[model samples]
Target: MTQPAKRTKKDKIGSGLKQQSWILLAIVLLAALIDYIWYDAHWVIAKSAALGACLSYLSQAIFAGFVFWHTGYRARRHIVRQMYRGQMVKWLLTVFGFALIFITIQPLSAPALFIGFMVMQISHSWMLWRIG
Candidate 1:
């Protein structure tokens, strides 16, 4: 009898990352709509909400991509090592992302941005709970 091929660690990581991304995107869009309608239907507020949500997600996505770029093609034996490296990179990217967003986006709505971020971050926990 032939045995099924084993999946690589990279494949497992990719699938989990994809699920995370989708959850973030859905929550971001929903938050954007709520921000728009709740905040006097202002485009600025809506845009801010969307940007904040996207930036929050981008922070993680960029790091995930970096992990894939640096480790995905490497030997599977190095996965555990790569995970630690990936986490450090993710943290750095997240800090840099927030700094960049704050510095570049003028007339930014702090409340909207923070609300979007908070909602999305909270949603992540909710998602994990549901999944687990």
Candidate 2:
């Protein structure tokens, strides 16, 4: 049987990414609402927390994309190499993302931002661990 086309694989991954983005955004919106209504958090803090979650999720998604960027039936060595590349790129993206966000976003709550990032990162890691 013929393997799937490269474009097809990429398109599938892209769609999955978009779907996950939407899910994460929805979760953040719900949390924002609850924080605003129940906790009496400032709008700025909620926005900052959402941005932080997005940053964490995006960095992780990029890593997953890189690892699975080009594959059908691949050798073990190739997969390992891709994983290493993904880890390096993910680290760089995360650091740069935080730097940019902090500099550009004003009136941000550092505690909330850190909490959002940590929560999302942990959940994402747990989900992947369960699936894999």
**Model 2 steric clash total:** 0
| TM-score (all chains, Cα) for each model | 0.62, 0.73
Per-residue C-alpha lDDT of model 2 across residues 1-132, encoded as one tens digit per residue: 987644325555555566567657865787689778977866766777788788888888888877776565555577678889999998999899889988998978788788778878776765655444
How many residue pairs clash in each candidate at the backbone level? 0, 0
Per-model C-alpha lDDT, please? 0.66, 0.75
Q: How well is each residue in 24-88 modelled by candidate 1, as lDDT tens digits?
A: 67765776677667866556666677677776666666555655554433455466666677788
Q: Model 1: which ten-residue window has the lowest total lDDT? A: 68-77
Best by lDDT: 2
Which runs of model 2 end up more than 4 angstroms from their true locations?
1-23, 38-42, 72-74
Q: How much does each candidate deviate from the true structure in C-alpha RMSD?
A: 5.1, 5.1
Candidate 1's displacement at residue 103, Å, is 0.9
Q: Which candidate leads in TM-score?
A: 2
